[model samples]
Target chain A: MPKMPEGTVMQRLAQLLFFSALMVFAGYFSDSPAYQLLESGQTELKLVVRHSGNIIGECRALDTGEIAALAPNMRRPMVCPREKAPMRVELDLNNKREFTETITPSGLHDDGVLALFRKFTLDSGDLILHLRITENPDAGGLPRDYEKQFQVDAHSTLIVEYTDSGFSSWQPQHSPRPRL
Target chain B: MKVEAFLDRFFPAGSNPLYQLGAVSFFLFWIIAVTGLYLFIFFETSITGAYQSVESITHEQFYIGGIMRSLHRYASALLALSVTIHLIKELGMKRFQGPRWFSWVSGVPLIWLLFASSLGGYWLVWDEKAQYIALTTAALFDYLPIVVEPMAFGFLDGTTVSDRFFSLLIFLHVGLPLALLLGMFIHIQRISNSSTFPARGLALSLLGAMVVLSVVKPALSLGPADLNRPVQTVQVDWFYMNVFPLISETGAGAAWVILLGITIALLLVPLIFRGVPKPIAIVDPDYCNGCSWCFADCPYDAIYMKPHEKLANHLQSVVVADKCVGCGICAGACPTATPFKSVNNAYSGINLADENNAAILVRTQEQIRQHPQADKHVLVVGCAHGPQIDQLASDVVTPLTLECVGQLPPSYLDYLCRKEGVDSVLLTGCAPGNCFHRLGVELQEARLAHEREPHLRFKDVHVKVTTLWAGAGGETTVARAVAQLQQDERIADAKDA
Candidate 1:
């Protein structure tokens, strides 16, 4: 059972004031006193891997009897593997391996592109970065490697994007302290 | 719970925030929707124009569009606070158990929806904070098994993201709330006469407070999001973006575990607090003439009318046992529960499996007959959920406690006053605005006022029926009301003399 209160005019006004004060206070700080999203003191290295490795097998012309053996729709003059070769990627800083991954192509037949995006925190200093990609190992495609050196600072971002043809790198400066 | 009771001293008349948390949240949603609509009028849903557009709204159009933007953000924060607190309060009260599990479970998805919508809203700004949110959210999703292509590829900063992606973000940010509104509608589906909006004054006060807060501290965006330049320290709205730091510093994998873990735990709340199930209402089809009163009165939507097996072409009330909380409001609505039934051991059309009105009537008859003789015989019928009333039983008054006062049929008053010669009946139950069974107090009040079915046949009874509702600590209040009732009856008798 609830005891009914007198609910005087003074009490109502006092409550309204109290509620308004509380609401305003909560509403203000609810999103106010905005905080930093991440602490400073480390550089962010984002390695974006986007590539379509070489096809698994070389295409070869069919012999006359082999061509006749194929079904009508499949009777193309040449035969090739439908799948792409797996790609292996590695990253090293100052000759020490920082990350390594073996990425498989997408799709049921594994005939699509290989992509792996990752971010690694690095200490702020001048250092060498080594990126290596090995594709079509079974089909004799040689490994490709690239290296760069830079004087990095806290909160700097070094994006290393790789493609089938080659690599592109960019180092964007960080805001002085923190941006609001 | 004690904190809520402390509010009675100030907000007792009409403005209890704790009582109106759900309704207050509805009010805040309305604020968000209206302000969001206003902001959308000037918003350009493109990545290039997104950040600049919001900046223009904040600085260029400071009065109209600017204030609307601030209100939108602030109201959302308030909504999150309101919703989280509401969940906590309901959990403390263990409202997730029993038939209420449906409501509790339905609300679980709404939390996720709220988070998703807020996340999308942040992305639309295309600021540094947006960059942080988009990347972290993408990283979290990338860990899930469903991602064939990495989800984070589209969010690799300025070079990869497309304008069309902004279109999608705006669509979800604007559209997901529609799903939330639908979920909210479903949440209160089982409850009858629900007030989604709060009292007018409270609504205005809350809106006024938000308006003031918006003017006090307008929301602003951080530097434009740069992918090449990774997000460092950026000011974040703590309410919506509390986990961004964790996602940024502790790894997305850890954040994934905690978020999913909390959601799973919330979903299992009812099971965690599951108590012995309450007895469900049972129907006696033979006595039921398909009146449909019980079907109409059931608060949980636990009763449905089906074709009577015994009576030709007549509808009979059937109870859905799983949904029934056994409040017995349906039994009170049953015409067969009328005290006028002459048949020995007669059953009501619908009744709690363990107790019936006939049994209550027999007990009440014995109590009234055994009471000490006096000029006036007053009986107090209360419920188990309300204040202790056994102390009120003495020479002048008799007390009868039922599972719920609503289980007492309206005509029971007529029976006590006419056949049993009781002077008056005072019906009591859970507090005025709060009923453990949701609709018990309201339904009982309606039946007494002759507004609903099973109306009291008080014409020839000459009995005074009064009602006073109090909660667990309200014994003093009930005693005062009882004393007032005695004084009123004596004065009436003196005037008649």
Candidate 2:
């Protein structure tokens, strides 16, 4: 309930003016061409891998006797790796190769513990995308090779994978954005 | 001079715009929230429609939708700036120490929450920059133990981004702000009389400025996101996106480490450094009537009213020891703390430690005796901070300094100017709008003006009040006022002769 002293009302007015000026300064200074550029839209495409097949080592049949010797009452899985395999991935957009990269498996040099991490961005639109991935590389080259094609739009992300049945692609559907 | 003092010169304490940064942030949040709701009405969450929907809102409804969109964006940026400045000011003033730890600790997470919410907002646009923010934020999240799947995978090659994912994004954009509001509430819970809204004039001016900015330069979205092309350069809002560049330079994992490290360090600060220690207010149940005056006046919510069995008053005063900042304003508000009142116990009501309590009275007495026989006997009451009235070379005035001008009961004004035979009372303290104790000068002013409780009873006595808004230069202003008062008194005496 305390009243402001003499001249305080004027002081408060001056403070408001100062702050309004600051807001004006900040807004104009920040809303430059660069900010305008950020505000506008652009075409972009992002690609990522979920379970990359780029193997780091050779995938070989597991020996049940060897697994049993290592651990009692143990059964060996069908797929085992002597070494980690290198996952080689290639991307072609509009029939033009835009990116190619190799990812190594995560665990052990690849006793079949394949862990591949790969991400890349490309142009967006109604474009054809040719993706190829090799699970394991032999002495000659990648023996497990998979390929697929996709048509995508701007601002879209495509997940490419090399699976047991060959290459596959999936584009997740977006939910309706909630309105107030 | 410290930045506080420099800024205080322009923004005095009684009611300054700078004093309302917290309130301004709250105001900006409301603005952002309301505008965001409007923008959301026409927004699309799908990767395909998100861009089109925002564009429609922009070009299709330029006058309303476009302006609202721009306001949402700009107000959000302003909110960030307001909060950062608020944090820095709190740090610079060392308000983060001591019992203020709750607010400081609570505030650290609010910043991250704000950033997270902002990122969600960007993603809703589904533009190139939104894409960039989405990818980087997912990459950053992937570094944490909680992330089982790299959220970045959702946007890869347009294959995994789903309606459910976009729904989560929308939820984040909406939900996190609510969380931030809750955090803000907790941040101010321990403080009494916290302003959740800025002054009406200040609020209106801020709204006007934002509207002008929105009309002048509307917010635009970056080009639609195309995963085939990497984001190169775009206009970035430095407030929310400053750390993005740092993340780009240092990699997501390193960025996470750096940010987490800083947050942890700041949270630990209140624990590591204790602020200056002071005596806590002691409550005397015998003398306390539980009138709640002290409870109402305590700037810090340190005192509480508790049920008392013996006294006729059902509730008595209790001081939460750690929460008390020992400003002694509570003592000043307590009726029993007045020295002039006859009390059964000297340690009655809420009192500071004896030494400090006795010192206040002794100091006032000694200072008043300095110029008793002067041509015009004058008592100058000022705050412990700002220009020191005691240091002034004036024969006509005696200066009494209090921890805060508000810490002196209204009765003191009557006792000094009337009973003590002083011709005039000159009240001075921090400049307009800048009381060190927040409401010290304000409370004192109201008491002297008889607008509040504990009114200054001697209405006929001459009492002059001035704010030392100029810091050190306030000394001259005080001296000149004293000389003028003396001269005015001499003239009146001569007329009587």
Predicted structure with the largest lDDT when compared to the true one: 1
**Residue-wise C-alpha lDDT for candidate 2, range B1-497, written one tens digit per residue:** 24445455454353455567888899999999899899888987776777889988988898999899988988888888889888876775566666777888999999999988887888888877886777677677766654444666565645446667677778888899899989999988988888788878668878888887788878888777665444556667776777776776677888988899999988988887766676677887767778788788887798989897468647888899878767677777766655566554223466765444435665666766776766677777776665688875366677877667777776666666655567777777765545555566666677667787766666765443443444434677677777887898899899999
- What are the TM values for chain B, all candidates? 0.88, 0.90
Task: Quote the lDDT for A24 in model 2.
Answer: 69
What tens-digit string does per-residue lDDT give for candidate 1 at B1-497?
55655666666543567777888889899989999988888888786688888888998998877789888888888888889888998887677778889999999999989988887988999887888888888888877645667877786655678888888888998789999999999998877667789878778877777677667777778888877677766676777788877877788789989998999999998998898888889998878889998888887888999899899989998998888887888888888877677784436778888878788888888888886475577888888777778999887788988777788888888877888878888887666556667677878988888888888887434868888766556678777888788888889899999
lDDT of 1: 0.80
The TM-score measured for candidate 1 stands at: 0.85
TM-scores for chain A, candidates in order? Answer: 0.74, 0.54
Which structure among the candidates has the greatest DockQ? 1
- Candidate 2 chain A: minimum summed lDDT over ten consecutive residues — where? A33-42
Quote the lDDT for A118 in model 2.
48
Judge candidate 1 at residue B184 and give its lDDT.
95
